[model samples]
Target: MFKKIAILHISLPIDQVYDYLEKRYNSTLYADASEQTKGYMPKIEIREATKNSFLSFYVKGHDPFTGLSVGSWKWSYTLTQEAGGMTKLKIAYEYGLFMSFISGGTVGHQAANEICETALALDALSNAQLAQ
Candidate 1:
């Protein structure tokens, strides 16, 4: 199993960020998949939390690379309110080898880097919006 993790301090409400990701990252976004994940439909499951103020989801789908057909994938996201009106988010993903075809080295590394950039950018956008 391969994993990637990212943390960000966002200037957005924790509930708002959580709600946005719960739909965007979870299987809900695939309701209208674009060619990339067509044949393999993923299942999204959410874990409700109150004590930790955290939300987690799991998606099961076919890995396009190893031809393994499909497997279960889990994504855990932690959100905590910081002292300075910012939300701390911790995002982690565990991937199966079946989908390694997207990137094993050059492509995968670049893709993950871009994803990290997007996360930072999203936080920036939140800051900008709040400023406005």
Candidate 2:
């Protein structure tokens, strides 16, 4: 099995970050992945989180390698108010692969790096949002 985790700490409030996620990545990716849930989607669900300080959801890998037969995954996040006029967003993603995919951590590290790229984009987006 291959496991990877990625996270980002944005300066925006938890609510604003959640809204950006819903408008940006949710429609194209998360919505399709979360077809099982109606009305409540990835970021929207964050509004109803048990703790107002955090938001979390999971998404599976659909890479050409894992394909359709592989298992699903969890990508959770927590947003917190920082001490020095900033906000922190923490993200975690985990995936388990088998057979040829589990041969090494090279692919897994690459996948994690890709996840980090996504997180970085989110950080940029938050910065833009804050600037506006």
Candidate 3:
């Protein structure tokens, strides 16, 4: 099993952050496509949502090294309002690999990759929000 957790503080209020993530989670990579067959499919499956607070989902996708779509990972995020009006976002992701042949690298490597990607995304979001 591989797992990773990340925390981010967004300057936006919890409600605003929640709304942004809600829309983002509902969005797909092929927004311009008119039909399902014509669109690029997204591997994310959102399982649950709690108004302005929490989200849980399953990501059916590939690890970078393996380059094969072979895992369904559980992911969750919790958002809380802080004293400074910032939103504290906690993210967790877990994947259990039953076969070693399918995993391209050590579990540590996979976890590190996941963490790096999550950090980069949060950084990008922070930068974008700051520019506004």
Candidate 4:
């Protein structure tokens, strides 16, 4: 099993970020016409949550780099209200990997890197929107 966690602090309010993610869940996240073109975009199935500030979903898809089936796992995102009206976005990912030539440790590293990159991208978007 490979597990990774990424946290990002967005300047936007928690409600705003929560609404943004909820909207994305309703629509296709990648918006690709084909799965091949979608590449690493995981098929996400939203799960239940007690609060609007928290979201959970399942993800199953090919490894972003190797195109190998990585099985399925639960991904949870928590948006916590923070000081200055900022939001602390925490993303946790846990998934199982099929046996392959690649080591599980390597896969975990790659997954962590991808998570960090994704967090940075999201933070950038939040900053941009806040600036506007």
Best TM-score among the predictions, by candidate number: 4
Pull out the clashing pairs in model 1: none
| Pairs that collide, model 2 | 9-89
**In candidate 1, where is summed lDDT lowest over 10 consecutive residues?**
102-111
Write candidate 3's Cα lDDT for 46-120 as tens digits: 789998789887866554555566656677779988988788888787777652345554554665676566557
Please rank every candidate by TM-score, starting with the best.
Answer: 4, 3, 1, 2
TM-score (all chains, Cα) for each model: 0.63, 0.57, 0.67, 0.69
lDDT of 2 by residue, 1-132 (tens): 445664556666666765665455557565765555333343333333435355455443344453443444555556677665466766665566542264354556655775777677677876787788
Per residue, candidate 4 scores C-alpha lDDT tens digits across 19-105 of 766656445544553345654455568786646578888766565577776556676778888999888988887766552224554
What clash pairs does model 3 have?
none
TM-score, candidate 2, is 0.57
Please give the TM-score that candidate 4 achieves against the real structure: 0.69
Q: Evaluate residue 21 in candidate 2 and report its C-alpha lDDT on the 0 to 100 scale.
A: 51
lDDT of each: 0.64, 0.56, 0.68, 0.69
